[model samples]
Target: MPMAADEIVSLIVAGIPDAQVEMTDLAGDNNHWAARVVSESFRGLPRLKQQRAVYAALGDKMGGVLHALQLTTAVPVQE
Candidate 1:
């Protein structure tokens, strides 16, 4: 079964707490996703680590139920 956008966002929020997540169904199949994640926690992390955090949020679902995810991560601009 494919995961829903809400589920994805919920997982991320649960993991990061302060994360703001935007999810897109890239293929309309609910399997392929593009996620833009922004959080203060990601501020000093390397891009690889930031992405890994998001993937970890999804837990063991990635490459299985979640399929492919095109992820973009960033720290919220201080303003």
Candidate 2:
């Protein structure tokens, strides 16, 4: 089964309380998704770690229910 876009956003936001998440369905099937997450918590972390946080948010769903995920993570600008 595929994951819903809102589910993805909710999980990521749950993981990163102050996160901004945007998701796109690459295949239009809701199975393949691309997520861009921006958070203050990611500020000093490595890119890989930032992405990992989003994945962690999804828990076991990452490779099972939601198989194809293209993730991009960034820290919010300090302005």
Candidate 3:
């Protein structure tokens, strides 16, 4: 089964309470997703750790239900 974009966003939000997530289905199959997450939580974290947080949010779904995912994460810029 494929995961819905909402479910993915919800899971990310569930873990990173202050995150802003944008999801796109690269394959139009709902299984291949490209997520752009902007969060204050990532401010000082390394790129690998930032991605890890989002991946952790998804848990086991990463390989089983989600199939493929491309993620980009960034910290919010100060104005």
Candidate 4:
């Protein structure tokens, strides 16, 4: 079974406490998703490292329950 959008967002936020996560179901099947996350944790981190953190939060679900994730991570923009 594919993971729920809220579940995925919760996991990401749990991992990155300061993260702001927004999720969109691109395919409406809960399999394809796009996530835009802004986090202070992303500061000074490479893009790959930021993505790894998100993936780590999902555990084994990456290839199992979660099929495709389009992820974007960035340091929070200044107001």
Q: Global CA lDDT of candidate 1, please?
A: 0.93
Question: Per-residue alpha-carbon lDDT of model 4 for 1-79, expressed as tens digits?
Answer: 7889899988888888888999999988888999999998888999999999999988888888887999998998779
- Model 3 quality (TM-score): 0.95
What residue runs in model 3 are displaced by over 4 Å at the alpha carbon? Answer: none
Which 10 consecutive residues of model 2 have the lowest summed lDDT? 70-79
Poorly placed runs, candidate 1 (over 4 Å): none
- TM-score per candidate, in order? 0.94, 0.94, 0.95, 0.92
Better of 2 and 3 by lDDT: 3
State the C-alpha lDDT per candidate. 0.93, 0.90, 0.93, 0.89
Q: How well is each residue in 1-79 modelled by candidate 1, as lDDT tens digits? A: 8899999999999999999999999999988899999999998999999999999998988888888889999999888
**Number of the top TM-score candidate:** 3
**What TM-score does candidate 2 get on C-alpha atoms?**
0.94
Q: If candidate 2 were superposed on the true structure by all CA atoms, what would the RMSD be?
A: 0.8
Candidate 3 at residue 34, lDDT? Answer: 97
Clash count, candidate 2: 0
Q: How much is the lDDT of residue 45 in candidate 2?
A: 94
Off by over 4 Å in 2: none
| Per-prediction backbone clash count | 0, 0, 0, 0
Give a tens-digit lDDT track for model 2, residues 1-79. 7889999898888988999998999989989999999999998899999988888988988889889999999888777
- Full-model lDDT, candidate 4: 0.89
